[model samples]
Target chain A: MNRDPVETLLRQADWAAGPPSASRVDLADRVRRLARRRHRTQTAVRATAAAVVVIGVGLAVHSATLRHRLDDRTVALPPPPAASPSPEEVAQLRSQLAQLQKEANDLAARIRSMTAIQEQRERLARMERAVARLESGEEVRAQMERAAFTIVYQADRMDRELGLRESALRAYRQAIRLFPETPSAKVARDRLAEINTQGDRL
Target chain B: MVDMVNGPALALDGDPLPTEREDDGLVARLARGDQAAFDALVAAHQDRVSRLAYRLLGWSGDVDDVVQEVFLAAWKALPRFQGRSSVTTWLTRITINECRSLRRRWGRVLHREPAETGRVCSPAADSRMMNGETLGRVRRAVAALPVRHREVVVLHYLEQMPIGTVSDLLGVSANTVVVRLHRARAKLKNKLSDLMQE
Candidate 1:
């Protein structure tokens, strides 16, 4: 008997069928990284708030500190200079104000990036995971070999263009492990042999 | 939006599914702040959540954020989980609510995609039916479905949940679910009249 067509069609529309748990480790890493980034952002905001309060305490605190520093230096009474904040104190406050201002701008930029390219970043992640999934899935072996080598070749070319020799080497090695006897694997071996004069297996 | 944080718990007809029973235990451990239990909970249920999200939402958009939010919300709310509904059911409710919020935020309902931009271009991701003129209509029809009607269809027909079970999971009367299913199917048949003829 034919199965229900509606159900089958709907199942086919399952966009959520991700590559599976092999990517779970990567996902977990992303989740952790995102959570940590959020936490750091919050901590930074709190620090900025605290620094602002310190800046608000302003001249009295500066004058008091100046008095204390003088007292510590002389251990004898030299009357306090003026109630005015010394140039150094003003300079320190200005430096801190500048630092907090820079931090606020940096945080804004970060938050903007988080929102602005978020959709694009997620789409890229999906594509990456799709490749990772296809590489590991139980598709036809011959087709998989072809697909695997293409992926390796692209990765190799991109890494080399970016001057990432180590990454390109790693990619070829990984391709071999994942798709042994594939065309790319043989090519990778020949390439490695070219790098190493010894004829022994790399 | 379904009240995932607090509201009526989805009753499973006085009998929890086997996974729900397991969820009860996992909930207990989770409330105790067991990290492994947290990992187990995510591992077991994320796939279902992801599928529900895709069904309720559409083929486009960033689903990973939704999944991340669902699990994060579950973790934060687990301590208060009363075991009234299974964790999975609670998660489904949360997924629906999240999808609703997303639709509201985006000011658009689910829309099917054949050549949608930013979709990463994967034919393997598409069903053969999706490419057909009639079946493309079917995708639009299903995507056009109001999430309320879509909910019953996804939980009942797609998930193969029984009527009573679906009713309890949605916190609605069984008759209401039945009515929704009938309405949804009628709409589908109307939309895909040519396919129906075949």
Candidate 2:
């Protein structure tokens, strides 16, 4: 029978793939040991991964809370007083203002009193001059009285022209009392009687 | 030329071992930590991995160690079986890898245990055609082929893998597998020419 020599040769070698000599018991025991080791390793790895994930979540939550607290603190805090004055500074300014107000009031009172005293002093000096002129001589006294009555007549006339009836009446009476015999005094008495008649008519 | 004298090696090419659905089901059960499923898996593939390792390494002493390593690896990976190939093809890949690892441990040198065959036949010769002497000669001829060529012959002829499957297992093009098979056959032919005619 003719045959392909190589095919014949391969067929001859097929026994190399014969039934294995390894028993089922031996292989089973080895496979069992391998399975146990694999189980243990997988369990350890999973536990470690779960721990890592939990710790990561905890850290994230803690960080977020800390940030929120810091933000709240920032919002609650007052801003620095860059433009507005502080309480101490405000108190100092008010004290200075009060001191200035008191000084101003005192100065006004002083000026008013000084004005009254100056008026009194002027009246006293005028009386003293009148006395001095009366004591010098009768003729000089009459001349002085006439000069004073003339000045009074001029002021009364100006006062009457300027619509100061009361002032004019007072000036006229003063002239009559101080220089009763002078010519200006007679004129003053006539003007006074005329003003009195006019007042009575009103 | 279908010159099949032994039924088992040729039979594997025609007969399906387990379907993809069976593999998918097995993987699912194994993934769920099903101990019985793992046992069933080891029982099913142990013999095949053992035989393939024995042939590839050309040594019997190393076959059991290679087979156990293959199963231990399978028990771990069967749960994650991707269904890219059948469980049978996937297991065969593991068997080859383990065999290669063992050989590498010994610096890629395989000491052929004198061809021990009580079963198998040749077509051009008698049914029981010189089982010891002739088989030994063929085994030496195959082992003498280059590593790439030798694996194709062992897978395509002795292990009865489809060319495409052998190609996939070796991570090469089908054409490349075919080419290697051709070259391996030619070399074996040249080596066994005088013996086959005897």
Candidate 3:
């Protein structure tokens, strides 16, 4: 009987094959890591929101507490300090006044710190917007000298997008010169050469 | 252009093959978030999947890794399994993509070692075809086929799948599969004959 070629070839394959080195533990761990990262990000966001709420509540309560303490002290003042009130009343009065002064000082200090933080956050938000505009391929060279890192990154991108190798090379060199030993400078130099080589092929 | 002309002609006259009802049901269950059904699918198709990967790329230490990755990708993409194509066909498509990626990585390594082409070269012989030198010649000939012809021939002859099923798996018409198989067989016969005479 003539043998079948298809059957003969099919018989050449091994019937049993095993799985790879990837284990159940590794797979489970990977899934868990993904879940944990998502959870951590959520928790961080909630915590920051909660901190803001807590600070607001603390400021409100402190304000109320100071108002009440000052009111009670004013109402309970000795009658014109007749014949010089007892040493205990004098001491208590002075202590309350001193506390009011201390509370005012503390509030002023907190206000100053809050103002500074607000200013910093506003600056950061503007910088983030500038960075976003640069990323979206817009030219915002107003603050190039002030923000050198962003300027270099945007220049490098512009050079690549415009296909101007020499211009890109110059920007990278400038970045390296200005911010020597910085990661941005190093990355700029590396990418500049990579793009230059690619340009050569063209 | 020739393939495009032939493609529609074959498709119009293609034979209708048996539907992969069981595999389809299993995949549907997997798409509905049933891990058990997905596991069953993996257990069912693991061997054929491994063999295809091994034969296409040669039996390397990475064959099993490729197979596992293929299954994982299948599991992730099961929800998008439109029933237009059979589950086996979908699996074959994914397997081909994975094999191509591995081949590309190997090509990069070979490029880096420009002086030595043989280091990353895939010898046609596999562990299963370790019968004799003649079989090795047959192996090399089959491996040398272009990917399209090679896929149809492998699924048809080596996997012992019906021509219609091979056609469906390849998303091509039965007649196209027929012509490819005919060409592949002719090439193999010629190559094998030359090797045998030596």
Candidate 4:
């Protein structure tokens, strides 16, 4: 491509000449200042980042050690044993036992009275049977013995209800001995056999 | 028709340009933060950088500022230079880019001030042109060219960079540079035809 005229025109332009030597020196000094500033900034940033990392690591290690100590304290201890009762507690328990024994005796006496009332009802029923036997011209003595056996059986039931097992066995033996020929005596003997077997099991 | 020069050889202040090896060594030293090396580089290349900025940016007070910025950028970017292109070519590219940016940034103000707008006449040509009126007219005509065409003309004619170097600096193909130069010269010929007749 041809460029003679354009080059001539450009060469004729005085402003196209290079800058003076003094300006070059000044501009170089400015560049050096800028470079130094940039380097300092980079160094500050790196130092700050490193310090932050170190502090963060130190805190993490400290907290981990504290947590480890807490775990050790929690895992190392054994549980305490249960405490025994005091003398006052034992005395209070003894007094409660004596009061329970007295209540049981009173309940036994009330059951004995109820048994006696049942015996009285049996005697009245025997009397009614004697009257009935006399009116029918039957043996009244035999019916009276059967009524005695029934009273003894009812007494044994009352003894069993009061939790008096030995008394119930004695009453049943007495009923069988006093009226051996009566049907109620046979029932009493059978009850005595069953109670003996239960006692033997116990 | 203009004369066809063999290579785009610019003779600035009649001083010898640095060899390729010297430029490489200077760039290496600058990368290593050698302030003396940077000063030497500035002394060697500042003329070309400032002259390019002056022609591209016209007669402005900020030409010194642009030159400072160019060197500062060069110092910062020295580490990543990689020696792909000569340091002068790289600095020239940066100077052109900075000039273009300054133009766009202050375009409105520059457009309003006709006297302060582009004027490129040599100090020696002042006596020949009788007060530089004719040279000022030609300079204004060259500045009035479109930015792309004007860039090609300034780099090719004023800066005297070879077609390939201009291509490398502008990051365009050589054919594109030739075409832009052709269009710019045609426009300049038309604009200065009356001056030539005079």
Candidate 5:
């Protein structure tokens, strides 16, 4: 009847039985579900990470393209200043110069007409002294007529210099009245006719 | 037969029962994720696994949970089985580890003294074979042993594993198991004199 007491006690302790079958089945099912859930979660995380990577790569490519385009535009700018002007631009510049030349010619013509009147006045003053010394009656009459014509011409030049078109027309009419047959009166008559014909075109 | 032996004598009676071929087939099917194979495996070894957990944890309700944990671990580890040990031995190792973890976790939370006086047997225990009060006292005395000694006692006596098998399961030397068992029996004798009396 001699035996180990601990061994005997353990053999006699019959409470350590397996659990019911239902629990085993339930546990097996729970473990399978957990494994499936883990697999699905891993797949979803991988897909989300892939999408993020693709979006990041696309943005990087797009920015690079935009940068390249900007760089191209900058590089394209420096060549234009070195190039000659196009034919159409040259034609437009030529037209502008011609208009400027026309304005200059008109200004010179007015200045020349003013100088001519001054010269005429000086010649008439000398002619008056010649007439006082001459003995011929016709020569004296011609000098007197010439002096009257020079005075009318001076009035016309003064009105034209003041930019007074109406005053210039009146001065021209007066010149024609005072020296109807003289050369100065004939030049004034021709100018009055030209101004009337030009009218508002001036 | 209580010789105060230095080493555990092999249980020649119930040894050599399950063939290695049968275990190999079951482990193979488990590795293939066959549910029927797993069910068959659990049906065959549930009792042994439950007994080890119950004895280790002093018959707490966590026994069933520990058994499920052990099988689940076995299922996961089947592919790496390498046929080094029998399925029973491998499961026994896992059960012991789970019980140890549960005890440590519960010990921290409840401030358990490890050797507390309490009823170790459930109400369903057979009273005719052993007096319920004496059995409860013996169960508590065994539960009071340190975790290492309790593991040796439970695997040696309750689960009926040999010293070599316990050493293999615990990954320790056979001499270590013998010394631990010798010390554990000495403590049990000191604690349960009334139960040990002829």
Candidate 6:
């Protein structure tokens, strides 16, 4: 091909035509950020999984150790005294039974409290997932209103039980502001005012 | 022409590798994951990609999109590149592939219709040509050619790549490239005839 210098020159001129106004730096930064986030998420998931595995192993080992210790304790404990009708022995036996009963009751209460907390966390997680699926803004706002209502009701009930009316009233006022059409806020306000009046008299 | 048959070292003129100090700096820095090197690579190759896209799409809006995609695709593939060819060759091949893909979607609009309007024209070259004017003009002329013709013209003429190298890039025969160059030059002469007549 006979290369015409002028046409060749014009063709070369076209190569100098710059890229669009969009920043390559921004593009690179975006790529870097996404890469870093991917690394962090992967690391976090592995770390969490590893922690769970470690905790599970530790619990299993501890449970085995405790079972062995219980066996050892049963073996080491002295035999019960002969079944003789004695007043002092009966009294000591009753006291020991009472102590064991008390300990059992305390453990049961703690278990129930822990179970309730876990249930609440699971409920919140479910709500979060539901919120994620609700694409409609109105639906999300309605959910927010319901949450606010429930929070105000719970806070007021807690405050009454715990003797903290002012904080409860503030929560009720927030709920009213968030959803003015609700009746919970009206009843809370009336009750709070009554509490304030009583406090003033005191 | 250097004998390309022996090894890449002897294949100097159509090596597709940049010989400039800045390009050397870029390769070294890029190996180190330097952000500046990546940016520089985009900056350097963007125009070449865009020009190829404009020619392929015939001055369409898809040029910028294709150009950006080409660089992005190059970035992704850069890590895996085994250095079989030079970075310019690798980038140019990517740009050419991207342009062809766009061509397939757009279905080859050769003759500009009266209805088709408001294409983002290439940046107006400074009328006063400086040091790089010869190469620049050749690039512009190559960009104004049809997609198929422009590929060979760019690879062979401006880049000074051998017909065999152009063939590999386009997945066509060396004979096809020679023929395309012949036709492209004829078309270029016709297109630039008005300027020559003036």
TM-score of each: 0.53, 0.50, 0.42, 0.50, 0.49, 0.38
Best by DockQ: 2
After best superposition, candidate 3 residue A20: deviation in angstroms?
10
Query: Which candidate has the top score in TM-score?
Result: 1
**Which tens-of-lDDT digit does each residue in B1-198 have in candidate 6?**
444222232111122344556566777777787888887777665545554555444333435457657776767776776556666667778877877786678675433321211111212312422223333334445556777887766555544567777787778887888888889878777655543322
Over the stretch A74-185, how does candidate 3's per-residue lDDT look in tens digits?
Answer: 6777656443445786687678667755765665576566557756865785588558758864333322322345435445433543344455566677777776655667
Taking chain A of candidate 2, what TM-score results? 0.31
* lDDT, candidate 5, B42-153, per-residue tens: 7777756665566677754435557767777776776787767778767777888887888777782122222221222223333423554565676677777888998888
Whole-model lDDT values for every prediction: 0.61, 0.63, 0.56, 0.63, 0.61, 0.56
Q: Candidate 6's residue-wise lDDT over A1-202, tens digit each?
A: 4546544444324322322222222445544544554466557556655755665566567557756755675667667654343477557656855665565566556556655665686578557745754764545554454455454544444365334455566666666776665555566567667878988999
Model 4's DockQ?
A: 0.10
TM-score, chain B, model 2, is 0.79
Write down the worst ten-residue block by lDDT for model 5 chain B.
Answer: B109-118
Residue A57 error, candidate 4, Å: 25
| Chain A only: TM-score per candidate | 0.27, 0.31, 0.28, 0.30, 0.29, 0.28
TM-score of 2: 0.50
What's the i-RMS of each model?
Answer: 8.9, 46.6, 17.2, 42.0, 42.0, 20.1
A104 in model 5: Cα distance from truth in Å? 78
* Winner on lDDT (1 vs 3): 1
Off by over 4 Å in 2: A1-3, A16-18, A35-202, B1-16, B112-128
Give the alpha carbon lDDT tens digit for every residue of A1-202 in model 4. 4436655555544332223212333567767775785576567556655755665566567557656754675566554453334567557756855665565566556556655665686578558855875886455454545354444534443354335455556656666676677676777778877877977999
lDDT for each residue of candidate 2 in B4-98, tens digit (9 for 90 to 100): 22222333323346566877787777778888877777776676666677677763454655777888888767667766776777888898887
Candidate 5, residue B103: lDDT: 77
Q: What fraction of the native alpha-carbon contacts across the interface, defined at 8 angstroms, is recovered by model 4? A: 0.30
Better of 2 and 5 by TM-score: 2
**Residue-by-residue lDDT tens digits, candidate 4, B1-198:** 323333645543334566789988987887787879878989898867776676776433436678878888887787888777878778887888777777788772142222221122234333433134665667677778888888888777656667877787888988999999999888877877655422
True C-alpha contacts between chains kept, each model in order: 0.09, 0.42, 0.09, 0.30, 0.17, 0.09
Instruction: Supply the DockQ value of model 1.
Output: 0.09
- Give the worst 10-residue stretch by lDDT in candidate 4 chain A: A15-24
Overall local distance difference test of candidate 3? 0.56
